[model samples]
Target: MRSEDALANIDVAVLAGGLGTRIRGVLGDTPKVLAPIAGRAFLGHLLDYLSAYGSRRVVLCLGHLADRVTAWLARGDSAGTIDVVCQIEPRPLGTAGALGYVRKELRSGTVLVMNGDTFLDADLRAFVASHRLSGAEASVLCVTVDDASRFGRVEIGPDSRIRRFLEKAPGSGTINAGVYLFSAAFVDRFIAAGAVSLEADVLETLPPGTLNAHIAKARFLDIGTPESLAAAASVIAGRES
Candidate 1:
């Protein structure tokens, strides 16, 4: 099915609250999401992309320098509807932990979660639709990278269900594209368990086949480091030209 048709029911959550220490050298005091890529902030482009994928509502998870992000979104510019929520961490809670902090705001039947540090060209609307139809508790967006050792690699069974989630394993395999679709039930589970890391804490408790993996077909770029950020700028520049 077409992505737009599938994603009509999903709400988007952009994870933008990290400290982004890795890229601080180039983006000092600036939240990674607010870092410029091409001629606009990276978060702006992400919002535009999500809107194109049929997202009607977007919730941004903000932490350090969150006010800048809030101001940027408040300016508007036809990038869909946006809501910014601060996710201050008393201590570093990791990925899933930060998400747990905002459980009250996630009221959608299906939620699409994306990392603010990366740019993925996957059809999120279609990804959401596939998750809803699969009857899985959660669906993760994945991509096959030449080097999977730097990120979490997901192994899928013949049934198309997630069998294993390996963190930073060497060699070629499918790695988490920093995106996901979670059912309302799964979100409830997080609230119940008080978990931290989504892969290590929450997903580990789920029964096998409960988590689904969807492979992305487009190029994926992670702008977490100074070098990668420069590359991202180049990519964005090329796109705009």
Candidate 2:
């Protein structure tokens, strides 16, 4: 579905709380989101993309040198419309914990969540509309990836409901695109499960047919390591040129 018609009332949550342990060798102490790509901080590019799609509000879940992020966002003033929420996990609380920490703030309606380290050329509107219409507790953005061995792969049933979630297996399949549209209630359930992976803690635990998948048409990039970051930079540069 087209973005214009799909995401009329959804809020966006960008998970930005990682330590960047993998890329620290290259970026040294810089938050991964602040890593330079195409002459601007990577998070800036993400915010620009979200704004382009008429995002109602953006909540950035920040941690690990989060002060730098706050200062950077403050200096730009472009993020004034974006809500910056801090999720300072005493230690890495894993992905689901960060979301749980902010459950109260996510007090209403469905929310679109994306990992700070990956990018997908998805129709956000269609993703959200599909989640709402499916009546599933959660909807994951999925894409066919050649190297499913490095990512969590999801299996959807004939009815389009998620049947199983496999994390980083040595095989090929449709993988999680690091983007999701979830009903608020589903997030609360994730919080109740304690600190664990989103895929392992929540997606895997859902009863059959409760979770759905929305296939996207965009290129997918996971920017977790230096190599992937360089690849993402090249992709962004080519798009601009």
lDDT of 2 at 181: 84
Where does candidate 2 have its weakest 10-residue lDDT segment? 77-86
**What is the C-alpha lDDT profile of model 2 across 99-132, one tens digit per residue?**
8776666644888889988876666777777777
Query: By TM-score, how accurate is candidate 2?
Result: 0.89
- Give the best candidate by lDDT: 2
lDDT of 1 by residue, 63-179 (tens): 778877767766774365544444555656667877787767777888888888999777666676667678887888888877776787787888778887776778988887888
- Candidate lDDT scores, in order, read 0.76, 0.77
Which pairs in model 1 have colliding backbones? none
Candidate 1's TM-score: 0.89
Model 1 / residue 187 / CA error / Å: 0.4
